[model samples]
Target: MPQHLTIVTHPLVSHKLTIMRKKETSTAGFRKLLREISLLLAYEVTRELPLTTETIETPIETMEAPVIEGRKLALVSILRAGNGLLDGILELIPAARVGFIGLYRDPETLQPVEYYKKLPEHMEDRYTIVVDPMLATGNSSVAAIDMLKAAGAKNIRFLCLLASPEGVARMKAAHPDVPVVTAALDRGLDDHGYIVPGLGDAGDRMFGTR
Candidate 1:
Protein backbone atom coordinates (compact mmCIF):
# COMPACT_ATOMS: atom_id res chain seq x y z
CA MET A 1 0.00 0.00 0.00
CA PRO A 2 1.21 3.49 -0.76
CA GLN A 3 1.65 6.07 1.98
CA HIS A 4 -1.13 8.37 3.07
CA LEU A 5 0.00 10.90 0.45
CA THR A 6 2.13 10.51 -2.66
CA ILE A 7 3.13 13.59 -4.66
CA VAL A 8 3.97 12.67 -8.22
CA THR A 9 7.32 14.24 -9.07
CA HIS A 10 7.61 13.07 -12.63
CA PRO A 11 9.30 15.78 -14.71
CA LEU A 12 6.65 15.67 -17.40
CA VAL A 13 3.91 16.10 -14.83
CA SER A 14 5.72 19.01 -13.21
CA HIS A 15 6.37 20.77 -16.52
CA LYS A 16 2.79 20.47 -17.60
CA LEU A 17 1.48 21.61 -14.24
CA THR A 18 3.60 24.74 -14.47
CA ILE A 19 1.92 25.61 -17.72
CA MET A 20 -1.46 24.94 -16.17
CA ARG A 21 -0.79 27.38 -13.30
CA LYS A 22 -0.19 30.29 -15.63
CA LYS A 23 -3.00 32.89 -15.55
CA GLU A 24 -2.99 33.46 -19.34
CA THR A 25 -3.48 29.83 -20.36
CA SER A 26 -6.63 29.52 -22.44
CA THR A 27 -9.51 27.30 -21.48
CA ALA A 28 -8.80 24.92 -24.34
CA GLY A 29 -5.12 24.73 -23.47
CA PHE A 30 -5.91 24.19 -19.79
CA ARG A 31 -8.32 21.40 -20.59
CA LYS A 32 -5.82 19.76 -22.92
CA LEU A 33 -3.04 19.96 -20.38
CA LEU A 34 -5.26 18.53 -17.64
CA ARG A 35 -6.11 15.50 -19.75
CA GLU A 36 -2.47 14.96 -20.59
CA ILE A 37 -1.35 15.37 -16.97
CA SER A 38 -4.03 13.02 -15.68
CA LEU A 39 -2.59 10.27 -17.84
CA LEU A 40 0.78 10.63 -16.13
CA LEU A 41 -0.79 10.80 -12.66
CA ALA A 42 -2.84 7.70 -13.40
CA TYR A 43 0.36 5.82 -14.10
CA GLU A 44 1.62 6.62 -10.61
CA VAL A 45 -1.61 6.01 -8.67
CA THR A 46 -2.07 2.46 -10.00
CA ARG A 47 1.54 1.47 -9.50
CA GLU A 48 0.88 -0.69 -6.46
CA LEU A 49 -2.11 -2.59 -7.78
CA PRO A 50 -1.93 -6.27 -7.03
CA LEU A 51 -0.63 -8.58 -9.75
CA THR A 52 -0.80 -12.29 -10.43
CA THR A 53 0.73 -14.46 -13.09
CA GLU A 54 -1.17 -16.21 -15.85
CA THR A 55 -0.10 -18.62 -18.52
CA ILE A 56 -0.20 -17.23 -22.03
CA GLU A 57 0.87 -18.44 -25.44
CA THR A 58 3.21 -16.19 -27.38
CA PRO A 59 3.69 -16.23 -31.13
CA ILE A 60 6.59 -18.65 -30.73
CA GLU A 61 6.06 -20.23 -27.32
CA THR A 62 3.95 -20.39 -24.18
CA MET A 63 4.92 -18.38 -21.12
CA GLU A 64 3.64 -17.03 -17.85
CA ALA A 65 2.66 -13.39 -17.81
CA PRO A 66 1.81 -10.97 -15.06
CA VAL A 67 -1.72 -9.63 -14.99
CA ILE A 68 -3.61 -7.33 -12.65
CA GLU A 69 -5.32 -9.52 -10.08
CA GLY A 70 -8.82 -8.51 -9.12
CA ARG A 71 -12.10 -7.14 -10.39
CA LYS A 72 -12.26 -4.38 -13.00
CA LEU A 73 -11.37 -1.17 -11.14
CA ALA A 74 -14.04 1.34 -10.18
CA LEU A 75 -13.27 4.95 -11.10
CA VAL A 76 -15.48 7.45 -9.28
CA SER A 77 -15.41 11.05 -10.36
CA ILE A 78 -16.11 13.82 -7.81
CA LEU A 79 -17.92 16.07 -10.21
CA ARG A 80 -17.92 18.17 -12.06
CA ALA A 81 -14.22 19.00 -12.27
CA GLY A 82 -13.33 15.42 -11.60
CA ASN A 83 -14.58 14.60 -15.08
CA GLY A 84 -11.45 16.16 -16.55
CA LEU A 85 -9.19 13.73 -14.74
CA LEU A 86 -11.60 10.86 -15.19
CA ASP A 87 -11.63 11.28 -18.97
CA GLY A 88 -7.89 10.78 -19.35
CA ILE A 89 -7.72 7.88 -16.93
CA LEU A 90 -10.55 6.17 -18.76
CA GLU A 91 -8.50 6.35 -21.93
CA LEU A 92 -5.71 4.40 -20.21
CA ILE A 93 -8.02 1.91 -18.53
CA PRO A 94 -10.91 1.75 -20.93
CA ALA A 95 -12.48 -1.24 -19.24
CA ALA A 96 -12.65 0.35 -15.83
CA ARG A 97 -16.10 0.70 -14.32
CA VAL A 98 -17.05 4.37 -14.08
CA GLY A 99 -19.20 6.18 -11.53
CA PHE A 100 -19.96 9.72 -10.35
CA ILE A 101 -20.51 11.54 -7.07
CA GLY A 102 -21.80 15.09 -7.31
CA LEU A 103 -20.94 17.43 -4.46
CA TYR A 104 -20.91 21.19 -4.33
CA ARG A 105 -19.29 23.32 -1.66
CA ASP A 106 -21.55 25.60 0.30
CA PRO A 107 -19.94 28.95 -0.25
CA GLU A 108 -20.94 30.35 3.11
CA THR A 109 -19.80 27.44 5.24
CA LEU A 110 -17.10 26.10 2.98
CA GLN A 111 -18.64 22.67 3.42
CA PRO A 112 -19.85 20.07 0.96
CA VAL A 113 -23.40 19.29 0.02
CA GLU A 114 -24.23 16.23 -2.06
CA TYR A 115 -26.56 16.70 -4.97
CA TYR A 116 -26.13 13.35 -6.75
CA LYS A 117 -24.32 10.01 -6.60
CA LYS A 118 -24.15 6.91 -8.78
CA LEU A 119 -21.55 4.30 -7.94
CA PRO A 120 -20.73 0.94 -9.46
CA GLU A 121 -22.02 -2.17 -7.76
CA HIS A 122 -19.83 -4.46 -5.65
CA MET A 123 -17.50 -1.67 -4.68
CA GLU A 124 -16.07 -3.85 -1.92
CA ASP A 125 -14.71 -6.23 -4.54
CA ARG A 126 -13.14 -3.59 -6.69
CA TYR A 127 -10.01 -1.47 -6.36
CA THR A 128 -11.72 1.90 -6.41
CA ILE A 129 -10.00 5.13 -7.43
CA VAL A 130 -11.79 8.44 -6.82
CA VAL A 131 -10.83 11.29 -9.16
CA ASP A 132 -11.11 14.98 -8.34
CA PRO A 133 -9.15 17.88 -9.84
CA MET A 134 -8.29 19.76 -6.65
CA LEU A 135 -8.08 18.87 -2.98
CA ALA A 136 -8.38 22.47 -1.85
CA THR A 137 -10.25 22.20 1.43
CA GLY A 138 -10.60 18.40 1.41
CA ASN A 139 -14.21 18.77 2.53
CA SER A 140 -15.68 17.29 -0.63
CA SER A 141 -13.04 14.57 -1.02
CA VAL A 142 -13.53 13.42 2.55
CA ALA A 143 -17.27 13.46 2.18
CA ALA A 144 -17.05 11.54 -1.08
CA ILE A 145 -14.87 8.86 0.48
CA ASP A 146 -17.24 8.63 3.41
CA MET A 147 -20.03 7.88 0.99
CA LEU A 148 -17.93 5.28 -0.79
CA LYS A 149 -17.18 3.48 2.45
CA ALA A 150 -20.83 3.50 3.28
CA ALA A 151 -21.33 1.85 -0.10
CA GLY A 152 -18.85 -0.88 0.94
CA ALA A 153 -15.74 0.30 -0.86
CA LYS A 154 -12.75 -0.89 1.19
CA ASN A 155 -9.83 -0.66 -1.18
CA ILE A 156 -10.14 2.95 -2.19
CA ARG A 157 -7.70 5.60 -3.38
CA PHE A 158 -8.01 9.31 -4.17
CA LEU A 159 -6.41 10.91 -7.24
CA CYS A 160 -6.13 14.64 -7.86
CA LEU A 161 -4.15 17.07 -10.00
CA LEU A 162 -3.23 19.39 -7.15
CA ALA A 163 -3.53 19.60 -3.35
CA SER A 164 -2.96 22.03 -0.51
CA PRO A 165 -1.21 21.14 2.73
CA GLU A 166 -4.30 21.92 4.79
CA GLY A 167 -6.45 19.79 2.52
CA VAL A 168 -3.96 16.91 2.61
CA ALA A 169 -3.79 17.05 6.39
CA ARG A 170 -7.54 17.15 6.70
CA MET A 171 -7.84 14.08 4.49
CA LYS A 172 -5.18 12.30 6.52
CA ALA A 173 -7.01 13.03 9.74
CA ALA A 174 -10.38 12.00 8.36
CA HIS A 175 -9.50 9.02 6.17
CA PRO A 176 -6.11 7.65 6.95
CA ASP A 177 -6.86 4.32 5.32
CA VAL A 178 -7.27 5.86 1.88
CA PRO A 179 -4.13 6.87 0.02
CA VAL A 180 -3.89 10.10 -2.00
CA VAL A 181 -1.96 10.61 -5.25
CA THR A 182 -1.46 14.11 -6.60
CA ALA A 183 0.68 15.94 -9.15
CA ALA A 184 1.66 18.71 -6.72
CA LEU A 185 1.00 19.97 -3.19
CA ASP A 186 0.85 23.71 -3.35
CA ARG A 187 0.86 26.28 -0.55
CA GLY A 188 -1.99 26.42 1.91
CA LEU A 189 -5.43 27.65 1.01
CA ASP A 190 -6.27 31.34 0.81
CA ASP A 191 -8.98 33.17 2.79
CA HIS A 192 -11.55 32.05 0.26
CA GLY A 193 -10.51 28.40 0.67
CA TYR A 194 -8.77 28.36 -2.67
CA ILE A 195 -5.22 27.11 -2.99
CA VAL A 196 -2.67 29.88 -3.33
CA PRO A 197 -0.43 30.04 -6.37
CA GLY A 198 -2.66 27.29 -7.70
CA LEU A 199 -4.65 26.93 -10.87
CA GLY A 200 -8.01 28.72 -10.62
CA ASP A 201 -11.38 26.99 -10.29
CA ALA A 202 -10.72 23.78 -12.18
CA GLY A 203 -14.27 23.23 -13.33
CA ASP A 204 -14.54 26.79 -14.59
CA ARG A 205 -11.22 26.69 -16.40
CA MET A 206 -11.90 23.32 -17.98
CA PHE A 207 -15.38 24.22 -19.18
CA GLY A 208 -14.72 27.84 -20.18
CA THR A 209 -17.12 29.12 -17.54
CA ARG A 210 -16.73 31.93 -15.02
Candidate 2:
Protein backbone atom coordinates (compact mmCIF):
# COMPACT_ATOMS: atom_id res chain seq x y z
CA MET A 1 0.00 0.00 0.00
CA PRO A 2 1.07 3.58 -0.62
CA GLN A 3 0.77 4.66 2.99
CA HIS A 4 1.39 8.34 2.42
CA LEU A 5 -0.85 8.77 -0.59
CA THR A 6 -4.42 10.08 -0.35
CA ILE A 7 -6.36 9.95 -3.59
CA VAL A 8 -9.25 12.41 -3.27
CA THR A 9 -12.15 10.57 -4.82
CA HIS A 10 -14.75 13.08 -3.77
CA PRO A 11 -17.50 13.29 -6.37
CA LEU A 12 -16.82 16.92 -7.15
CA VAL A 13 -13.13 16.25 -7.55
CA SER A 14 -13.69 13.32 -9.84
CA HIS A 15 -16.35 15.12 -11.86
CA LYS A 16 -14.17 18.11 -12.55
CA LEU A 17 -11.22 15.89 -13.29
CA THR A 18 -13.24 14.09 -15.93
CA ILE A 19 -13.98 17.33 -17.71
CA MET A 20 -10.36 18.34 -17.48
CA ARG A 21 -9.27 15.07 -19.04
CA LYS A 22 -11.28 15.62 -22.17
CA LYS A 23 -9.05 16.71 -25.01
CA GLU A 24 -11.67 19.14 -26.26
CA THR A 25 -11.72 21.15 -23.03
CA SER A 26 -10.83 24.75 -23.80
CA THR A 27 -8.08 26.66 -22.07
CA ALA A 28 -10.59 28.83 -20.25
CA GLY A 29 -12.60 25.80 -19.21
CA PHE A 30 -9.51 23.92 -18.12
CA ARG A 31 -8.31 26.80 -16.02
CA LYS A 32 -11.68 27.27 -14.38
CA LEU A 33 -12.07 23.59 -13.64
CA LEU A 34 -8.59 23.46 -12.18
CA ARG A 35 -9.32 26.37 -9.88
CA GLU A 36 -12.50 24.71 -8.63
CA ILE A 37 -10.93 21.27 -8.24
CA SER A 38 -7.97 22.70 -6.38
CA LEU A 39 -10.20 24.20 -3.72
CA LEU A 40 -11.65 20.77 -3.01
CA LEU A 41 -8.18 19.24 -3.00
CA ALA A 42 -7.03 21.87 -0.51
CA TYR A 43 -9.78 20.84 1.84
CA GLU A 44 -8.66 17.21 1.77
CA VAL A 45 -5.01 18.07 2.16
CA THR A 46 -5.58 20.29 5.19
CA ARG A 47 -8.23 18.11 6.83
CA GLU A 48 -5.81 17.13 9.56
CA LEU A 49 -4.78 20.63 10.52
CA PRO A 50 -4.49 21.02 14.28
CA LEU A 51 -7.14 23.13 15.97
CA THR A 52 -7.34 25.11 19.20
CA THR A 53 -10.16 26.76 21.04
CA GLU A 54 -10.36 30.52 21.26
CA THR A 55 -12.64 32.64 23.42
CA ILE A 56 -15.07 34.63 21.35
CA GLU A 57 -18.31 36.47 22.00
CA THR A 58 -21.22 35.38 19.89
CA PRO A 59 -24.46 37.34 19.44
CA ILE A 60 -25.95 35.27 22.25
CA GLU A 61 -23.05 34.48 24.55
CA THR A 62 -19.29 34.24 24.99
CA MET A 63 -17.91 30.87 23.89
CA GLU A 64 -14.86 29.02 22.79
CA ALA A 65 -14.55 28.49 19.05
CA PRO A 66 -12.17 26.25 17.24
CA VAL A 67 -9.43 27.78 15.15
CA ILE A 68 -6.26 26.51 13.57
CA GLU A 69 -3.43 26.29 16.07
CA GLY A 70 0.12 27.68 16.10
CA ARG A 71 1.86 29.77 13.45
CA LYS A 72 0.25 30.51 10.11
CA LEU A 73 0.60 27.87 7.39
CA ALA A 74 3.16 28.11 4.61
CA LEU A 75 2.06 27.27 1.03
CA VAL A 76 4.88 26.44 -1.34
CA SER A 77 3.98 26.29 -5.03
CA ILE A 78 6.32 24.23 -7.19
CA LEU A 79 6.63 26.85 -9.92
CA ARG A 80 4.57 27.81 -13.00
CA ALA A 81 2.23 24.86 -13.07
CA GLY A 82 1.95 24.87 -9.33
CA ASN A 83 0.51 28.36 -9.59
CA GLY A 84 -2.78 26.98 -10.94
CA LEU A 85 -3.23 24.90 -7.80
CA LEU A 86 -1.81 27.69 -5.64
CA ASP A 87 -4.35 30.28 -6.78
CA GLY A 88 -7.33 28.21 -5.77
CA ILE A 89 -5.72 27.24 -2.46
CA LEU A 90 -5.07 30.91 -1.75
CA GLU A 91 -8.78 31.56 -2.13
CA LEU A 92 -9.30 29.09 0.70
CA ILE A 93 -6.26 30.17 2.73
CA PRO A 94 -5.82 33.85 1.97
CA ALA A 95 -3.63 34.39 5.02
CA ALA A 96 -1.23 31.54 4.41
CA ARG A 97 2.41 32.49 3.88
CA VAL A 98 3.35 31.85 0.24
CA GLY A 99 6.53 30.56 -1.38
CA PHE A 100 7.53 29.49 -4.87
CA ILE A 101 9.96 26.96 -6.31
CA GLY A 102 10.73 26.95 -10.03
CA LEU A 103 12.04 23.88 -11.78
CA TYR A 104 12.20 22.99 -15.45
CA ARG A 105 12.93 19.67 -17.09
CA ASP A 106 16.06 19.52 -19.25
CA PRO A 107 14.66 18.52 -22.67
CA GLU A 108 17.40 16.10 -23.61
CA THR A 109 18.25 14.60 -20.26
CA LEU A 110 14.72 14.80 -18.82
CA GLN A 111 16.19 15.86 -15.47
CA PRO A 112 14.82 18.57 -13.25
CA VAL A 113 16.81 21.78 -13.05
CA GLU A 114 16.01 24.34 -10.42
CA TYR A 115 15.92 27.92 -11.59
CA TYR A 116 14.31 29.80 -8.70
CA LYS A 117 13.14 29.36 -5.11
CA LYS A 118 12.02 31.70 -2.35
CA LEU A 119 10.53 30.61 0.94
CA PRO A 120 9.17 32.20 4.06
CA GLU A 121 11.46 32.66 7.05
CA HIS A 122 11.34 30.28 10.03
CA MET A 123 9.95 27.48 7.89
CA GLU A 124 10.48 24.96 10.69
CA ASP A 125 7.86 26.72 12.79
CA ARG A 126 5.02 26.31 10.28
CA TYR A 127 3.10 23.54 8.57
CA THR A 128 4.12 23.59 4.90
CA ILE A 129 1.95 22.44 2.03
CA VAL A 130 3.61 22.05 -1.36
CA VAL A 131 1.31 22.44 -4.36
CA ASP A 132 1.70 21.24 -7.92
CA PRO A 133 -0.93 20.29 -10.50
CA MET A 134 0.79 17.10 -11.66
CA LEU A 135 3.26 14.65 -10.15
CA ALA A 136 4.48 12.67 -13.18
CA THR A 137 8.03 11.40 -12.73
CA GLY A 138 8.40 12.63 -9.11
CA ASN A 139 11.82 14.07 -9.81
CA SER A 140 10.68 17.62 -9.15
CA SER A 141 8.55 16.63 -6.19
CA VAL A 142 11.43 14.78 -4.52
CA ALA A 143 13.85 17.58 -5.22
CA ALA A 144 11.40 20.15 -3.91
CA ILE A 145 11.00 18.19 -0.69
CA ASP A 146 14.75 17.93 -0.38
CA MET A 147 15.03 21.68 -0.62
CA LEU A 148 12.32 22.19 2.00
CA LYS A 149 14.00 19.86 4.50
CA ALA A 150 17.36 21.47 3.92
CA ALA A 151 15.70 24.80 4.69
CA GLY A 152 14.36 23.49 8.04
CA ALA A 153 10.81 22.61 7.05
CA LYS A 154 10.03 19.43 8.98
CA ASN A 155 6.24 19.12 8.78
CA ILE A 156 5.30 19.02 5.11
CA ARG A 157 2.57 17.74 2.80
CA PHE A 158 2.60 17.30 -0.97
CA LEU A 159 -0.59 18.29 -2.79
CA CYS A 160 -1.21 17.72 -6.48
CA LEU A 161 -4.12 17.30 -8.88
CA LEU A 162 -2.79 14.15 -10.56
CA ALA A 163 -0.14 11.52 -10.01
CA SER A 164 1.24 8.50 -11.86
CA PRO A 165 1.90 5.16 -10.16
CA GLU A 166 5.56 5.63 -10.84
CA GLY A 167 5.47 9.09 -9.32
CA VAL A 168 3.75 7.89 -6.15
CA ALA A 169 6.23 5.06 -5.69
CA ARG A 170 9.17 7.35 -6.25
CA MET A 171 7.85 9.86 -3.72
CA LYS A 172 7.22 7.20 -1.09
CA ALA A 173 10.71 5.83 -1.54
CA ALA A 174 12.25 9.27 -1.26
CA HIS A 175 10.05 10.91 1.40
CA PRO A 176 7.98 8.34 3.18
CA ASP A 177 6.82 10.72 5.86
CA VAL A 178 5.28 13.44 3.71
CA PRO A 179 1.70 12.65 2.86
CA VAL A 180 0.65 12.88 -0.79
CA VAL A 181 -2.84 14.21 -1.58
CA THR A 182 -3.89 14.08 -5.21
CA ALA A 183 -7.14 14.07 -7.14
CA ALA A 184 -6.24 10.91 -9.07
CA LEU A 185 -3.50 8.36 -9.58
CA ASP A 186 -3.31 7.58 -13.27
CA ARG A 187 -2.05 4.32 -14.81
CA GLY A 188 1.56 5.47 -15.10
CA LEU A 189 3.90 7.73 -17.01
CA ASP A 190 4.65 7.42 -20.70
CA ASP A 191 8.07 6.85 -22.20
CA HIS A 192 8.44 10.62 -22.56
CA GLY A 193 7.65 11.07 -18.83
CA TYR A 194 4.14 12.52 -19.16
CA ILE A 195 1.35 10.95 -17.13
CA VAL A 196 -0.33 8.52 -19.58
CA PRO A 197 -3.83 9.95 -19.37
CA GLY A 198 -3.09 13.26 -17.68
CA LEU A 199 -4.75 16.48 -18.81
CA GLY A 200 -1.54 17.39 -20.60
CA ASP A 201 0.83 20.24 -19.70
CA ALA A 202 -1.23 21.90 -16.99
CA GLY A 203 0.66 25.15 -17.29
CA ASP A 204 0.07 25.28 -21.00
CA ARG A 205 -3.59 24.49 -20.67
CA MET A 206 -4.08 27.02 -17.93
CA PHE A 207 -2.03 29.80 -19.49
CA GLY A 208 -2.57 29.01 -23.20
CA THR A 209 1.16 28.61 -23.69
CA ARG A 210 3.16 25.76 -25.18
Candidate 3:
Protein backbone atom coordinates (compact mmCIF):
# COMPACT_ATOMS: atom_id res chain seq x y z
CA MET A 1 0.00 0.00 0.00
CA PRO A 2 3.04 2.27 0.06
CA GLN A 3 3.60 4.78 -2.71
CA HIS A 4 5.92 3.78 -5.53
CA LEU A 5 5.58 0.17 -4.37
CA THR A 6 3.47 -2.51 -6.01
CA ILE A 7 2.37 -5.33 -3.72
CA VAL A 8 1.38 -8.29 -5.83
CA THR A 9 -1.78 -9.68 -4.27
CA HIS A 10 -2.60 -12.45 -6.69
CA PRO A 11 -4.09 -15.44 -4.92
CA LEU A 12 -1.31 -17.68 -6.16
CA VAL A 13 1.38 -15.27 -5.08
CA SER A 14 -0.16 -14.81 -1.66
CA HIS A 15 -0.53 -18.55 -1.18
CA LYS A 16 3.08 -19.26 -2.07
CA LEU A 17 4.30 -16.40 0.07
CA THR A 18 2.49 -17.81 3.08
CA ILE A 19 4.37 -21.05 2.70
CA MET A 20 7.66 -19.19 2.63
CA ARG A 21 6.91 -17.34 5.87
CA LYS A 22 6.61 -20.49 7.90
CA LYS A 23 9.85 -21.45 9.67
CA GLU A 24 9.36 -25.16 9.05
CA THR A 25 9.51 -24.77 5.27
CA SER A 26 12.51 -26.76 4.05
CA THR A 27 15.21 -25.30 1.91
CA ALA A 28 13.95 -27.02 -1.22
CA GLY A 29 10.39 -25.98 -0.49
CA PHE A 30 11.48 -22.43 0.14
CA ARG A 31 13.42 -22.26 -3.09
CA LYS A 32 10.56 -23.67 -5.11
CA LEU A 33 8.09 -21.28 -3.56
CA LEU A 34 10.37 -18.36 -4.28
CA ARG A 35 10.66 -19.34 -7.92
CA GLU A 36 6.90 -19.62 -8.31
CA ILE A 37 6.34 -16.30 -6.62
CA SER A 38 9.03 -14.68 -8.71
CA LEU A 39 7.22 -15.58 -11.89
CA LEU A 40 4.04 -13.88 -10.72
CA LEU A 41 5.96 -10.92 -9.38
CA ALA A 42 7.85 -10.59 -12.66
CA TYR A 43 4.57 -10.37 -14.49
CA GLU A 44 3.59 -7.38 -12.41
CA VAL A 45 6.93 -5.59 -12.66
CA THR A 46 7.04 -5.75 -16.44
CA ARG A 47 3.40 -4.87 -16.91
CA GLU A 48 4.21 -1.43 -18.25
CA LEU A 49 6.99 -2.45 -20.61
CA PRO A 50 6.73 -0.88 -24.00
CA LEU A 51 5.48 -3.06 -26.81
CA THR A 52 5.42 -2.97 -30.58
CA THR A 53 3.74 -5.11 -33.21
CA GLU A 54 5.44 -7.16 -35.89
CA THR A 55 3.62 -8.58 -38.86
CA ILE A 56 4.01 -12.32 -39.12
CA GLU A 57 2.25 -14.94 -41.17
CA THR A 58 0.05 -17.18 -39.10
CA PRO A 59 -1.34 -20.54 -40.11
CA ILE A 60 -4.50 -18.86 -41.36
CA GLU A 61 -3.25 -15.39 -42.31
CA THR A 62 -0.65 -12.70 -41.70
CA MET A 63 -1.24 -10.57 -38.63
CA GLU A 64 0.52 -8.12 -36.41
CA ALA A 65 1.25 -9.49 -32.95
CA PRO A 66 2.44 -7.41 -30.06
CA VAL A 67 5.96 -8.06 -28.91
CA ILE A 68 8.36 -6.39 -26.49
CA GLU A 69 10.38 -3.70 -28.21
CA GLY A 70 13.88 -2.28 -27.91
CA ARG A 71 16.99 -3.89 -26.46
CA LYS A 72 16.78 -7.01 -24.33
CA LEU A 73 16.08 -6.26 -20.67
CA ALA A 74 18.86 -6.33 -18.09
CA LEU A 75 18.29 -8.40 -14.95
CA VAL A 76 20.78 -7.48 -12.26
CA SER A 77 20.78 -9.76 -9.24
CA ILE A 78 22.11 -8.49 -5.94
CA LEU A 79 24.53 -11.31 -5.27
CA ARG A 80 23.64 -14.82 -4.01
CA ALA A 81 20.10 -14.39 -2.74
CA GLY A 82 19.07 -12.43 -5.78
CA ASN A 83 20.08 -15.31 -8.00
CA GLY A 84 17.10 -17.36 -6.83
CA LEU A 85 14.62 -14.72 -7.98
CA LEU A 86 16.61 -14.22 -11.17
CA ASP A 87 16.24 -17.86 -12.14
CA GLY A 88 12.44 -17.82 -12.12
CA ILE A 89 12.27 -14.52 -13.99
CA LEU A 90 14.53 -16.00 -16.65
CA GLU A 91 11.90 -18.63 -17.33
CA LEU A 92 9.60 -15.82 -18.43
CA ILE A 93 12.23 -13.55 -20.01
CA PRO A 94 14.68 -16.14 -21.24
CA ALA A 95 16.48 -13.82 -23.64
CA ALA A 96 17.02 -11.02 -21.15
CA ARG A 97 20.60 -10.04 -20.32
CA VAL A 98 21.89 -11.03 -16.89
CA GLY A 99 24.12 -9.10 -14.51
CA PHE A 100 25.22 -9.17 -10.87
CA ILE A 101 25.92 -6.57 -8.22
CA GLY A 102 27.48 -7.88 -5.01
CA LEU A 103 27.40 -5.89 -1.79
CA TYR A 104 27.88 -6.77 1.84
CA ARG A 105 27.07 -4.64 4.86
CA ASP A 106 29.89 -3.82 7.23
CA PRO A 107 28.91 -5.17 10.65
CA GLU A 108 30.10 -2.10 12.51
CA THR A 109 29.09 0.62 10.11
CA LEU A 110 25.95 -1.08 8.81
CA GLN A 111 26.66 0.43 5.41
CA PRO A 112 26.81 -1.51 2.20
CA VAL A 113 30.17 -1.99 0.52
CA GLU A 114 30.44 -3.35 -2.98
CA TYR A 115 32.49 -6.45 -3.52
CA TYR A 116 31.76 -7.05 -7.20
CA LYS A 117 29.75 -5.78 -10.16
CA LYS A 118 29.59 -7.09 -13.71
CA LEU A 119 26.93 -5.63 -15.98
CA PRO A 120 25.93 -6.14 -19.57
CA GLU A 121 26.72 -3.57 -22.24
CA HIS A 122 24.16 -1.00 -23.49
CA MET A 123 22.46 -0.89 -20.10
CA GLU A 124 21.39 2.65 -20.90
CA ASP A 125 19.01 1.39 -23.55
CA ARG A 126 17.66 -1.74 -21.94
CA TYR A 127 15.07 -1.70 -19.20
CA THR A 128 16.84 -2.89 -16.04
CA ILE A 129 15.31 -4.76 -13.11
CA VAL A 130 17.21 -5.32 -9.86
CA VAL A 131 16.29 -8.43 -7.85
CA ASP A 132 16.80 -9.21 -4.19
CA PRO A 133 14.71 -11.33 -1.80
CA MET A 134 14.47 -9.13 1.28
CA LEU A 135 14.62 -5.37 1.52
CA ALA A 136 15.44 -5.04 5.22
CA THR A 137 17.78 -2.13 5.79
CA GLY A 138 17.69 -0.80 2.23
CA ASN A 139 21.36 0.15 2.37
CA SER A 140 22.37 -2.44 -0.19
CA SER A 141 19.32 -1.69 -2.32
CA VAL A 142 20.18 2.00 -2.43
CA ALA A 143 23.81 1.28 -3.12
CA ALA A 144 22.92 -1.11 -5.91
CA ILE A 145 20.66 1.49 -7.54
CA ASP A 146 23.39 4.07 -7.21
CA MET A 147 25.75 1.81 -9.08
CA LEU A 148 23.17 1.07 -11.78
CA LYS A 149 22.49 4.77 -12.26
CA ALA A 150 26.17 5.57 -12.46
CA ALA A 151 26.56 2.88 -15.12
CA GLY A 152 24.09 4.69 -17.40
CA ALA A 153 21.00 2.70 -16.54
CA LYS A 154 18.20 5.17 -17.20
CA ASN A 155 15.08 3.12 -16.56
CA ILE A 156 15.18 0.70 -13.64
CA ARG A 157 12.74 -1.21 -11.44
CA PHE A 158 13.32 -3.08 -8.19
CA LEU A 159 11.83 -6.53 -7.66
CA CYS A 160 11.84 -8.44 -4.41
CA LEU A 161 9.98 -11.18 -2.53
CA LEU A 162 9.45 -9.25 0.70
CA ALA A 163 10.07 -5.72 1.92
CA SER A 164 10.04 -3.86 5.23
CA PRO A 165 8.43 -0.47 5.56
CA GLU A 166 11.71 1.07 6.62
CA GLY A 167 13.37 -0.33 3.53
CA VAL A 168 10.58 1.02 1.31
CA ALA A 169 10.93 4.47 2.86
CA ARG A 170 14.67 4.37 2.48
CA MET A 171 14.43 3.40 -1.14
CA LYS A 172 11.72 5.99 -1.81
CA ALA A 173 13.84 8.72 -0.28
CA ALA A 174 16.93 7.66 -2.14
CA HIS A 175 15.50 6.87 -5.57
CA PRO A 176 11.91 7.92 -6.15
CA ASP A 177 12.24 7.29 -9.86
CA VAL A 178 12.57 3.53 -9.45
CA PRO A 179 9.39 1.54 -8.89
CA VAL A 180 9.45 -1.39 -6.45
CA VAL A 181 7.47 -4.59 -6.93
CA THR A 182 7.23 -7.20 -4.21
CA ALA A 183 5.03 -10.01 -2.95
CA ALA A 184 4.54 -8.50 0.52
CA LEU A 185 5.55 -5.45 2.50
CA ASP A 186 6.22 -6.53 6.05
CA ARG A 187 5.94 -4.45 9.23
CA GLY A 188 9.36 -2.90 9.60
CA LEU A 189 13.00 -3.59 10.40
CA ASP A 190 14.07 -4.88 13.79
CA ASP A 191 16.86 -3.45 15.87
CA HIS A 192 19.32 -5.81 14.23
CA GLY A 193 18.33 -4.46 10.81
CA TYR A 194 16.32 -7.56 9.94
CA ILE A 195 12.77 -7.45 8.67
CA VAL A 196 10.43 -8.23 11.53
CA PRO A 197 8.56 -11.50 11.01
CA GLY A 198 10.65 -11.92 7.88
CA LEU A 199 11.42 -15.33 6.44
CA GLY A 200 14.86 -15.03 8.06
CA ASP A 201 18.12 -14.58 6.19
CA ALA A 202 17.06 -15.26 2.61
CA GLY A 203 20.55 -16.33 1.55
CA ASP A 204 20.69 -18.87 4.37
CA ARG A 205 17.15 -20.11 3.84
CA MET A 206 17.65 -20.59 0.11
CA PHE A 207 21.16 -22.07 0.24
CA GLY A 208 20.80 -23.98 3.56
CA THR A 209 23.81 -22.24 5.08
CA ARG A 210 24.27 -21.65 8.80
- Quantify all predictions' global Cα lDDT against the true fold: 0.95, 0.93, 0.93
What are the per-residue Cα lDDT tens digits for candidate 3 across 131-210?
99999889999999999999999899999999999899999999999999988999888778988888898999999997
lDDT of model number 2 = 0.93
Weakest ten-residue segment in model 1 by summed lDDT: 1-10
Candidate 1 C-alpha lDDT tens digits along 82-194: 99999999999999999999999999999999999999999999999999999999999999999999999999999999999999999999999999999999988999999
lDDT of 2 by residue, 139-185 (tens): 99999999999999988999999999999999999999999999999
lDDT at position 6, candidate 2: 94
Model 2 stretches astray by more than 4 angstroms: none
Order of quality (lDDT): 1, 3, 2
Window of ten residues with lowest summed lDDT in model 2: 1-10
Model 2 residue 191 distance off true place after TM-score fit, in angstroms:
1.0
